[model samples]
Target chain A: MSVRVVVRTFSELCITVGAVIVLFVVYVLFWTGVKADTAMDDQIAQLEEQWAKGSASAGPGDPGSARGPGAAAPKAVAYEDGRPFAVMYIPRLGFTWNKPVLEGTRTKTLKKGLGHYASTARLGEPGNFAVAGHRRTYGDPFKDFPRLRPGDPVVLTDGTSWFTYRIDTRPYRTLPDDTAVVDPVPEKSGYTREGRYLTLTTCDPEWGHSHRLIVWAHLDETQPVEAGKPKALRR
Target chain B: MYGFIWRHLPGNTWIKALISLVLVLATVYVLFQYVFPWAEPLLPFNDVTVDNQ
Candidate 1:
């Protein structure tokens, strides 16, 4: 072959190979993302449905008969009872990690709730019921946590009973520490210390963990399973 | 602009088809291998925990 013709063929071959690689990368980055998103959405929706049904292990009982002002019903099952204490549904962000939320952060519990402080307080108590969760790993359970706003429901069910709370605040300015986030009552003057509350804590900045994100809510209402059931479980 | 056309030249039909095929295979492999596994845990996976272990 002539020198110029040989060089031209070699150049075209290089171009064709490079184009193939570029196209491959684009398909991996773009189309792969599209498919993953679709699959994740469908799976989340299905799991949310499963969460709506009353837990398989929950025995029939009147869950809220004992609940008075700041009174919690007898905890039917221990944190390790394998019964899900709460049905954490975040519709806006599409989260339905229905694993058992351990009441204490043991090695096993922390693995699920990220971390737990037993000394802090118990649920529906006067002190902090502090819990933590990983921001990125382990299913990224609370990755879209920042999307939570005031008035979102945080539902907690103790197998036989269910409790509902409304998201009260997302305070970024309270303090650099986690104490205020999990505090039982308002440290400030205007806030009342009488109502039952639920606080959710997770690592902040979405995938990045520069700080902690605290989502707090107050008990809106409660009922035993025989009385009023959550709309998700009604069907 | 001398180097622009040199970089932008279209390939022959056979080369173009080969390039597209490689792209499709690579995409399929990535979706099945890395992306699918990383995203699977987000879905329900038969509740295997340490207690079960």
Candidate 2:
């Protein structure tokens, strides 16, 4: 090929590659969020449908029992992998901000919504109930995690009961290998004994995962579904 | 490069535009379906867990 043709062809190839790179960025940042939002909505809708049908197998006890003296103990629901068992609502984030809590912490599970650590204690249980969510992409369920403060409520519902947790500690940074943050009695949160706790974890620095940002909360109260709504959820 | 592609094609402007659109779409489809999936494991996008290593 002639010199002019060669230069022109080389420039054209560079432009094509640049366009592809931009497209890939768009796919990762924009397209993934759109797809994840739809997936999360569908997952929430499915969970609501199951709850409406009263088909959710929430442990062994009768789910109709109300919270009071002599009421039956709330059994920990047996959660299946990739299935959503609860809906988490963070009023501090937004009035309408909610996400489905899936069972496992795999990439596919987190993409749908927040992923509950399988080994951690269940919601409202007398242990550390931990959850993980994406910080930057895939709908970014915890994108505003740093905005949470002490006394903020992290409420969750399992179709039959509402569990509200009050944030006691702000965002604490730790390494990705530090699994103790999700322990039944978390070591770094200043709690000496076991109690009903909730831990929210996400990637740090908005877009990087070199470390984790953790927020520790204590379960404050529980209300039955027959109760219209919790005080914390009231606008 | 787009100019070169236009010159090499034997169609009018409308036909050239259609052909260019198709080529871009085909390239994007291949990248998303094959290239991105193959490259996802190597990327650090999904390693945000605090699990015990």
Candidate 3:
């Protein structure tokens, strides 16, 4: 090729490569969110169907009456990886700001919704029940996580009962290597004794995961599905 | 590069546009299906994790 033609070809190649890179960024930021939203909607629909059937068979017995304060605590059901076991609702985020809580904290699980740390306490139990979610992309379920404030209510339901947790502290920035944020007592929360705690974890700074944003809450109340939604959830 | 492709292709402007579209899509497909997957683990995206300590 002549010198002029060679220069023209190099410019064309550079433009094509630049366009490809732009397309890739669009795919990662936009297409992934679309796919995640579809997957989460399907998962939520399936869980709702299962809960409807469960309640139908359980009859009119009040769920709260079965597990009152003095009653023996029900056995915690084992959850399979990537399987959703509960739905989390943060009224402060928005009335529609709810996501399915899956069993494990793997990438695949977080794409569907929130992922519960396997080592943490189970929902509505004594220790710290911790969950992790993506702050950006993959539906960005915790996109508004920074908006949470002390006294904000984070509610979760396992189809039969509703667990309402009150945020006691603001978002605390921590390094990715700090696992003590989810400890049974969570010394980071200044607790020395065991108590019912809920921990929400997500990537800090919106688009990056260099650090983690931790929010600690205490279980404030528990009610049955038959008793209607909790007062915190009331509009 | 595009000039050479245009001269070598045996079609009108419409057909050339279609061919160019196909080539771009094929490039993307190869990058995502093979190249990107190979490079993913090398990136720091998945390095975000809390230590057991």
Taking all chains together, each candidate's TM-score versus the true structure is 0.51, 0.88, 0.87
Candidate 3 local accuracy as lDDT? 0.80
TM-score of chain A of each: 0.59, 0.91, 0.92
Candidate 1, residues A136-210, lDDT tens digits: the string is 544455666777788676665543456666777763433334355555674531247655666666655554434
Worst 10 residues of 3 chain A by lDDT: A68-77
CAPRI grade of model 2: acceptable
- Higher-ranked by DockQ: 1 or 2: 2
Model 2: per-residue Cα lDDT over B1-53, one tens digit each: 66767888778989988988998789889998788656654556665569921
**Candidate 2 has which clashing residue pairs, if any?**
none
Please report, in order, the local distance difference test score of every candidate based on alpha carbons.
0.51, 0.83, 0.80
DockQ of 3: 0.36
Which segments of model 1 are wrong by more than 4 Å?
A1-70, A74-87, A95-99, A106-108, A113-116, A125-127, A171-176, A186-190, A232-235, B1-53
The better-scoring model by lDDT among 1 and 2 is: 2
Ranking by TM-score: 2, 3, 1
Per-candidate DockQ values are: 0.07, 0.49, 0.36
What docking grade applies to model 1?
incorrect
* TM value for model 3: 0.87
Can you give the lDDT of residue A85 in candidate 3? Answer: 85
Give the DockQ of candidate 2. 0.49
Over 4 Å off, model 2? A55-64, A68-77, B1-13, B32-34, B37-43
The top-ranked prediction according to TM-score is 2
